[model samples]
Target: MTPIQALYYFVEARPTRTGPPNVGIGAILLIVAAAVFIAWVAWLWIAARPSSGGEETALNLQPYLSDDELETTKLNRVLRAAM
Candidate 1:
């Protein structure tokens, strides 16, 4: 056979087979990075939430009074200002 015919025969003789789709390295890394970012944001959101029962312990009452005292003080101040 001639060289051109042999080349054409060689090209057509290969088997045609379907294969699994390929996933790029960048796509895999992007998925992993997105998952990590979501986890990080979730952690930050959870950490930033107000802690119940912890506010009372963190409050210092030296410069402030109880709610009853504050109301009475406000009333007295208003009365004094009205005079």
Candidate 2:
């Protein structure tokens, strides 16, 4: 046999059937990235939801009424009639 072939056999450096070593690491990194992205989207969705506080004020009916006729009972009646 040639010297090169003999040397190769002595070193026992055979071809590998598996792919590159970094392939598994790359897959794991992609999975982690997907998880992080999903978590961020979910956080944004939750933060955008309306709160259950009583801070939402009703539309001012006083604008449609005159100064002399400005009354809550009158406004409620007018609103009910309009609706």
Q: Pick the candidate with the highest TM-score.
A: 1
| Candidate 2, residue 71: lDDT | 69
Off by over 4 Å in 1: 1-21, 54-83
TM of each candidate vs. truth: 0.40, 0.39
Candidate 2 residue lDDT tens string, 2-52: 999999897787776676686688799999999999999999999999998
Question: Quick one: how many clashes does candidate 1 have?
Answer: 0
The ten-residue window of minimal lDDT in model 2 covers 61-70
Off by over 4 Å in 2: 1-23, 54-83
| lDDT (tens digit, per residue) of candidate 1 on 1-83 | 99999999999999876885588788899999999999999999999998785445446555667789878988799999999
What lDDT score belongs to each candidate, Candidate 1 first? 0.87, 0.84
